[model samples]
Target: MERERVNRKIAAIFAADVAGYSRLMGMDEEGTLARLKAHRRELVDPKIVEYYGRIVKTTGDGMLVEFPSVVDAVRCAVEVQRGMVERNAEVPQGTRIEFRVGITVGDIIIEGGDIFGDRVNVAARLEQLAEPGGICVSGRVQEDTQGRLEIAFEDAGERQLKNIARPVRVYRVRPSAAAATARPALTLPEKPSAAVLPFQNMSGDPEQEYFADGMVEEIITALSRFKSLFVIARNSSFTYKGKAVDIKQVGRELGVRYVLEGSVRKAANRVRITGQLIDATTGAHLWADRFDGALEDIFDLQDRVATSVVGAIAPKLEQAEIERSERKPIGNLDAYDCYLRGMASLYQWSKESNDEALRLLYRSIELDPAFVSAYGAAAWCYVWRKTQGWVANSAQDKIEAIRLARRAVELGKDDAAALSAGGITFAHIAGDLDGGAAFIERALVLNPNLAGAWLNSGWVRVWLGEPEVAIEHLARAMRLSPLDPILFRMQGAMASAHLFAGHYDEASAWAEKALRENPNLQQGLRVAAASHALAGRLEEAQKAVARIRQLDPDFRISNMQDRLPAVLRPQDFARYAEGLRKAGLPG
Candidate 1:
């Protein structure tokens, strides 16, 4: 293939960004955004057009411009700053939106309506150095603009900028001094927020539009239940239904951190829902998954799609937040930050990480005593310990776990994450099978879209000795979060449910699937051994038993009941023990 040619030119680059953008958003997000939009519409754009400047692209809080002459660029920057000063005259100094403009005359590469190269980088860095409502220029720009304009230049000495090979002298333009403080601006909600745009009907049938619109509405309603998230109302999200949207623009307009956009394709008896979660501010694709099912189960399909999408993206959003928190200075860490960090550790699925996660979670609770999710997650850490055999029948541990679970349930009556997590803790650690199942069922009622809740309910059903019911719940959970980080947990539960239901072949198959993802999962190994032995796969069963021995040398059939859920039916436990004996496990 012939390579596309490169384009380069010497241009005067103008870069400007809002000062203290984050703080401004935090203070009065809507008002700050409204003012910024008005400023751009009335002052900044007009000045740039008057100066013969070409607008390149705009980030959420910043814009880049190009001019043929450095003098024109400097003039535009000066006029914009002057206009801002006038606009802020009637506004409070603290809430005023201020622009910091940086002009540099340098070579840039242009392609596909975007400019690139080191000059662009320098302009951005220079913009960062400018004071609020002020203008800064490079030596070259200062030289070209000098005496060509009425603006006075203040000599800002040579400064070494990041990633720049050489220190470049800078000059500040003395536009009428405008006072702007590092106060608040329009910011996304502190809690993770999202908007679900209407899904396009790609079936080439106009009548299918309702199905697509209904999908978006259902998703918006379901996502609203995540008390940890701020979801845009259905009406607001539907406004962008058929429009070709810019994700960043949508994010700003809706004030959300993420946007979910997708399309629905239907053919006789079958429909497919495809969705992609995007980081609205940065336009990054965080996650994407598709669900395909029969059209006869239309409502159920919608519910499944909503649950799966929420289940998949919730963790992705949390992971994105964790990454953002990781970038903050250590001293700036807050309770939420600690909670995110703790969750990051908890997901590692190791003893040491679980311990660290518990410590951090408790620290979060200490920082904010009313943090319900922290209590729930801390309780989950205890559940993890027991499941991993790190703790066994410790009455004190069980009491502490129960205490945390109860507090979580009491405080977070409507929080699905808190409820589901607490439910799992109660069931697995405290052996309150009925109460645990009730908590999870309530969570499902509150947020039927929560995959984790479905997963928890499935396991509880298995312990309740309703193997067939457990299988259906587990299958639903899998459909809801096919790519979930804890997918192995769901798979292992399926294996157990199948083994108890006497589908030995299906049980072995699912056990293998679980072990494929988590080779050292003790539960998976035990299930694999039992299923394989019952299915007459003698060699495979013996090998799984050997591996289990390596993981827990003291393991024996006599004490297996301690490892399994205590509520397991007597006959189910006997069958499992018999299978293990057949697999050559010692009594």
Candidate 2:
């Protein structure tokens, strides 16, 4: 006999899951299982019952439920998630038991007290699209729950669902705290302005999430190197992290005209990165591209991705910047003076000068902590010390470097000087390669005329595996500061960039220029030796090595990581080490 079809009615579906269920299980079976049961008993079950929700079924790591009202469902979801945040206060990010929630209001078949329909399916899909500690809901659910609930929703646009009939419009639910502390909508910049939104880590492994962030940060720094864009600070842009964000809303919040977004996926030593530039005002795509490479070749991959994005946007941004500069007035004199004084000390490029520069910077910050340039210069002092091999205490220096860089980025969101300096140190000292790049780029966007930002940006680009772009940026820095007292530093960096790119002759030429000003410069001597050795100029390479030995008779290729601040990538460092070995550096 044929069974009667069940009647259909409107229902609110909620989907919930542990952020990293498999990972949690892999890390600890009995403990994870115990925690899940304890959470369900203490929190999840109580909320479901209180909100008039019916538990349809339970998967070991997730649950599906039907609520009588969308309001009840959303409220319960938010509370449960918020409770988790408080529950995880003492827990580290690496192993937190965060929950992602997805709610939808839709039609469902009522059969034997179990619901079956696309509404339930949509909720599941939205959950998949949510950030680890966030929530996602369908448009209808957001609409029905609006005004009825005190929650804020961000339009995530249409997402293609697996095994679904059509694209679904999803919105991300912002945490209550984020909404409470939200900045007043900003005034758009007169010039071209942009914010590189944090890249999505499409890689399922939570450990690789930082890789994606680092990539975005590099791109932001790269784009900032261009003098024409008003770039928002990394901290501001990151406010949207783990939230489903509307592009237009991001523009309004950040006061930027353009927005760049992307994703990174890594698996089995291979990585695929994809990015798109958008006209935030029009919701139109300006540019898009994908980069694929071996994971070990990550530095090169990041450079190519960043270079392409920068090349695509330069013309448009330049036009906007000129327009804005015409409308904007100059900076404050006292603050500017203090910043310049700090710069004077920085340019001296010795330990005593670095110390003096730091003192001047501290006074500048005291006078006006808003002077982002001073913060950048201060952070650079630490980087300089590390590069010159003068830091006697690595651990304490690293801690201080990170603390200062974090503060510079926090307080100097609109300042290019602050971002670049802080961003570079974050990489070298804190090992936050992605974050450092982002801040540096933001600085470039704020004040492209800042020659030092370009100089430091060039150095990081080489570390990120874009020696070609590094050379270009350094060249621009030299042009901007034709007679700069620190001109030798620029020339030496250029030499290293060329050496990194395997352009031996160009490396040799730039190194010679650097040596002309500071004959004892260790960086210039090292690059000249390495490039000459690799290019088969054995006599010249040996001569360069002899000079290097004169400066530091204890130098050896074996201690390359400790000695060479520029070698962040293993392959590049190994290649340079080999060249040093060939040039007869001991060990």
Best by lDDT: 1
Tell me each candidate's TM-score: 0.48, 0.43
129-234: candidate 2 lDDT, tens digit per residue: 8898799998888888776665788998998888789998899987445555754344454556778888999999876655676567556655555555566545
Poorest 10 consecutive residues by lDDT, candidate 2: 321-330
Give me the candidate number with maximum TM-score.
1
Whole-model lDDT values for every prediction: 0.80, 0.77
RMSD of each: 23.7, 21.1
Model 2, residue 375: displacement in angstroms?
2.2
lDDT per residue for candidate 1 within 383-468, as digits (tens), equals 77777677755678889999999999998887776899898888887778888888998998876656678888999988888889
Q: Which pairs of residues collide in model 1?
A: 23-184, 23-185, 24-184, 24-185, 25-185, 25-186, 25-187, 29-186
